[model samples]
Target: MKRYISIYSLLIVLMFGMVSCEDLFDQKPLDSTPAEDILTNEKDAEALLYGMYAYFGSEASYGRSLSTMLDIMTDASLASTGFSNQLGQMYAWKINPGTSEVGSLWGNHYGAIYNATFLINNLHTIEGDQDNLNRIKGEAYVGRALLHYNLVRLFAKAYDQATAATDLGIPYRLDYEDVTPSRSSVEEVYSNIVDDLEEALQLLPVNERYDEETFTLDFANGLMARVLLDMKDYDGVIDHTSRIINNPAFSLSSGQAFTDMWLKDSGLEIIWRVGYRITDANLVAPGYNFFNMNNVSSPLLPDYIPSDSWVNLFNSSDIRLSTYVATAATGYGWTSKLVIKYPTNPDFASQVLGMNMPKPMRLAEMYLMRAEAYAYTNNDEQAVADLDALLENRIENHQGVNISGDALKDLIADERKRELMFEGFYWFDLKRMGKGFTRVPQENTSTANDLSISADDYRWQWPIPTSEINGNTIIKQNDGY
Candidate 1:
């Protein structure tokens, strides 16, 4: 009655002395060293860590499905006319335990957890530079926390103080053991996520700014802030977010710099991102979910477009409106406004179009999180200041606002939608806010199914994958399917 993950294969065992891939992201082993000789030195440990990063960059994970699926499931985006059926099931609210996207997301996230836990468990056995080893181990913990956090968010109910203690959560796997474990409570899963981040903060280097490609102290703190916000620990969110805000290394990107951050994947605000090299074999660009352009002259084929209501959320003078949304011909009969947040990076256009990096942690998010937390805590003045600061950077000729109470809170929520759209926060934001939405037909697009989902719908919690339930008898399926 143990949980099982089909991560380790004979080829992987022979090739990398750990989990090897058969169909998992079609990835190859980073090193061909025999399983028995793996983790014998510093290089081996780093190789294993790299394998975890590869999983992060896979289409099954952040590279595409994780973000795209969550977005399309919400009202913020709709399937375009003559759209490819990519994630159409999720967008239409027709997913079940047997859905392919569900199964892939479940398995891929667990695969990442396996890699992180393997690296964490074995890294200490290798003698290396103490500082470097600590940093690697720290990154592994952060990866584990991130993977589990995503799993719980997708598979379990949104964290509710009244019900989370009794609600089921995904297994918080800590080691690479072949033991079957039952799902933990939602509260327990969130607690473990925070614990992992705390460990990462201790081990990660204290620096002004770490490379955006690597996890650092700021990344750990930023993640903790997000986790705390989810748990409704407003004070805790303020404390962690303030740490990153005060640091001189990070600032909000504005004007042309902000536009380049999305198009070029270069900016001062990116705290950490899943980076991709043009030569990498598994390179599924995040933008491929939204639009595709073979060349500058080619017509854009957008699989999904922002909903009319969502498009209307941004003000005309807001920089995000111009930077993120663009109207283009779909190569079909109609033209539509496309989400260009992950547009092609000019540097890699010749090799791979739409190959922008996925920025999971950013400085902009901190201000939004802090503003929400402050509003909840009755710190109206500070909340408004945060809102003003963020708006000043995002809007052209933006004026400061003076507001408090529920009005300020409402503004913060809308601001989050405007600022973080398409980066995959819509559905989850709706869930945590205890709100439901209806997807109405857009003026130009009649393809929207007009789906209405309530806050109390069982579908809010995605069903545990059928394969997982069948493989691990001890596991319980989500209530709906």
Candidate 2:
């Protein structure tokens, strides 16, 4: 069950650090600590910020697990592959983490929530430049909101305009409470997500040196666009992405530079990302922040090959195909798999998984979001132009596309799927349009392999985590979990 804190106990435990307080208070403490107590120095404060990145990187969260889980679960007009079982579970609307990885997603996203709460609950106390304090707080706010968004997608139903007002969602928590907490409604969750973005926008500077990690205001805005898009708030989508589209830092990379740039940690497009740490134990896959696991950070081994479908998506002369891949012959064999983005550095010894993890938001996507908003708003010219701008830069034989009506919309959606494959946007796209998860387009059945559904089942919204139900009796669960 969801647990909460008591207002009083949450404070004493703040500066004092974690101690045995079970006997001291009957209920958990809530938000009693001020921000000053959080940091003794800048480094201490910075260290605390890393917790947000870690939370996002956890297997249950966006890290490798989520990216893989989301894609395999979808039937993309392609036949089923080895990852089809759990994928079936997702496509079918039957995912109970009480027994599977869904639990990990619940655990990790909340871990992010807990960390963000701790930091935001205490960020103000650090007696530094007010500007610095505000930046940190702003980031914490964005991080907290982003984590909540991740949780809601996995735990609550899709934001059905008809039922969202009444649908239950994960509990909304921003303070350091220790009391058992319950879930909120889906509408409440969306409201909270938007609220956080607004606050984060206000507090976050237009730009900053967030070390090799962290999200900026533009990044937060991009995320806001995504959340709003899911809620069917098309105007909100345009309003948010426009902030970055209005800015110059966000642009599509072209030619070899695009391929080369993806592997770098400090590129202009990344609004936020989990830095790759390359030690065997910490080693993780390399690829886009997209959902497809086919994109590895390392090159393919002697016989290791890509999914035949992923390869055939583009033609022999198409740009993305050759640019994004490498044979066993490339780069000292450090990366022999997909190696879609960052690869292991040749200089590092005792190699492990690359720590350069995924980012929830980036610049390349900003263009697509803007294009989509324009497409739906009936601005076909702007829509095609924006998408063309991206496509021209990505593929070699790419000619400008002229599309109209539903076919155009579908093409745009397909373009996004091809461009952002592993980044985790496909399923969300289908659901907002009330589509299905099946590739065969058989029928809209809920179970995996039924082949009836369009891969659009709202079941992707994860079942409520056990901790919430078992711990907080006051809470309620979503239906069809």
In terms of TM-score, which candidate is strongest? Answer: 1
Per-candidate TM equals 0.91, 0.78
Return the lDDT, model 2, position 368.
87
**Candidates' RMSD to native:** 5.3, 7.6
> Compared with the true structure, what per-residue lDDT tens digits does model 1 show for residues 90-176?
888888998887887787777767667777777877787998899889989998998899989889999989999999998887753
For model 2, residues 1-481, the per-residue Cα lDDT tens digits are 1112221232233323222222111122233444454456756665566555555555556655556446545654222222224334454446673645666566556655655666777666567778877887788888888888877776676788889888778777766454656677889999999998898899988755344366778778888998887776778888888788777666667766665555454466667665544432233443322212332455322211233445456666555566544433333233232424334333222343333456556676887888888888888898888888788777676788877877778878877777766567766666566676433422211224434454444465666656556655666666665
RMSD of 2: 7.6
The weakest ten consecutive residues by lDDT in model 2 span: 19-28
Look at candidate 1 and tell me the lDDT of residue 465: 81
lDDT of 2 at 40: 69
- Our model 1 lands, by Cα RMSD against the true structure, at 5.3
What TM-score does candidate 1 get on C-alpha atoms? 0.91
